[model samples]
Target: MTISFSDLPIRDEFRGMTPYGAPQAPLPVALNVNENTHPIPDDVATDIVDSVSLAVRDLNRYPDREFSLLREAFAGYLGHGLSAENVWAANGSNEVLQHILQAFAGPDRTVMGFGPTYSMYPLLTQATGAQWFAGERGPDFSLTAASAVAQVEEVNPNVILLCAPNNPTGTPLPLDVIAAVYDATDGIVVVDEAYFEFAPHDAPSALTLLDGRPRLVVSRTMSKAFAFAGARVGYLAADPAFIDALRLVRLPYHLSSLTQVAALAALRHADTMLATVDNIVEQRDRISATLTALGYRPYESWTNFVLFGGVADPQATFLALYERGILIRDVGIPGHMRVSAGTEEETTAFLDALASLEF
Candidate 1:
């Protein structure tokens, strides 16, 4: 007899909730998830393999509990006067977030974020036994300093999650709004910058605000611009005391030795690994321009994806693309869909397929 999940001993909060994921399929041209479609440089991959191979000989011992060397490398890459003391990393940005929530938010505590942002924020909050409070964004999915501060003052959450260049909508969050929100809340403030490398070179990061602010954290990932999504590496920078809080909750030696070495190897070739960012940005712009020309409204994105509106039927359009072996995302936004900036040819296939469809 098959047992029902509802009859099991799962937590009440998880009873009816679905796990978070995009539709995964083996399509010819897939831009559903915002992944860097570019392959790692052959030389870099070889070096990573060599590094991992060396690490393989030490399988008997547990990895460094602090992951000091990797932290130092991340510090060097991020610069901005950040040192190893300010850096903390986990398997992925999601885990980094989970750690933050676990440390500062739990049972009866509230975590808040603006709507139409990264969907994972709410899910992560719930999983950590914290209440999820969704604040609103503008009609165009934009947020300003005054608006953000007002929401934070009202909710008074224990933790605030700000997704810079937000997911699902691609709206860029200005530093002024972040500073205002930080000033408004005594809660721990997290700025998730998973797509920071895709933003303009001159764009100021939340890292610039970290010096005097102990409650502020700036999280980043090597998954996108580094073409290391499969490696599952993400990191953050904050006051050393804040990093200490994460350590209190993290499992001992959470990072594997192999993961540490592979990440170190990738960091050594950071410049070479990031060469595809410009090309991806170009494709993203191309998608936006062509979508606008075709009468769809595309938002200004500072990430490697575009969220376009004017789809009369999002599901129908999604299925139509699926039939053509070109998969994109329908991010539960009415009359809108999101697509990643794939390689040039893949982007062409998506555009050509989209153009052929009627409302």
Candidate 2:
């Protein structure tokens, strides 16, 4: 007899939970999931293969538990006066965040984020046995300093999550607001800059704010900007103490030799790896502009994706796009949906499909 998941001795809180993920249908012109969608340049691919080959000889031994060289490479990439001592790496930003929660938050603690933010923030908090709650965003998904401070004051959570170029909305937060929130909360303040490279040129990184604030942690991921989503490398910059805290919680040799080598190879070719960022930005603007012209309300996007509102029927529109061999995300936010900027041809297909729709 087949045992249902419900019949297993799972924790009551997890009895009916579904893992967080977007639909993964194999369709042409796929624009969901906020992936880079650009193929790795040939030179980068070759470099990755060569680097991995070098690591193959040492596979029998444990990989670098410290990941020292990899940490230096990442610190150099982040470059806001960061050193390897201030950096920590994990399989992805999600795991990086998990390490943080494991270190700072648990049972009696609470974590808070602005509403309609990244879905994983709450899920990750739950996994740590912490209470997760949401503060509301202003009209147009805007997060203001005043509003952020009010939420921090009200909740007084042990940890606070702020996402720049926030997921599902594509809105970047102002540093002033982050500072305000930081001032209000004595606990850990995490600024998730997963889409930092996609933000406007004038936007500043939270890394610059790290010096005086030992409790501030800025998390980033190579999956988005470096176009190495397949490599699953993510990292963060914070006070050396914070990095040390994460070290205690992370498993020994968690980063595989192959992952380390692949990430190092990509960082070495950083220019080539990030060469398409500009193009993706252009596509993002095009999507926002064209959507606006089509009488849809597309939020100002600082990321590779746009979250647009005023769809008459998001599910129907989503299914229609799927039928036309294109796929976009519904994001389950009322009449709004999000779509990632794909290659030019793929992006054009998505726009053309939307243009063809009668509603």
Q: Which candidate leads the pack in TM-score?
A: 1
Cα TM-score of candidate 2: 0.98
Estimated TM-score for each candidate: 0.99, 0.98
Error of 1 at 6 (Å): 2.0
| lDDT tens per residue, model 1, 1-359 | 88878779999999988889899999999898899999898999999999999999998999999999999999999999999999999999999999999999999999999998899999999999999999999998999999999989989999999999898788899999999999999999999999999999999999999888999999999898998899999999999999999999999999999999999999999999999999999999999999999999999999999999999999999999999999999999899999999999999999999999976
Q: Which pairs of residues collide in candidate 1?
A: none
Residue 114 error for model 1, in Å? 0.2
- In model 2, the Cα lDDT at residue 159 comes to 94
Least accurate stretch of 10 residues (summed lDDT) in model 1? 1-10
- The numbered model that scores best in lDDT is 1
Q: How far is candidate 2 from the true structure (C-alpha RMSD, Å)?
A: 0.9
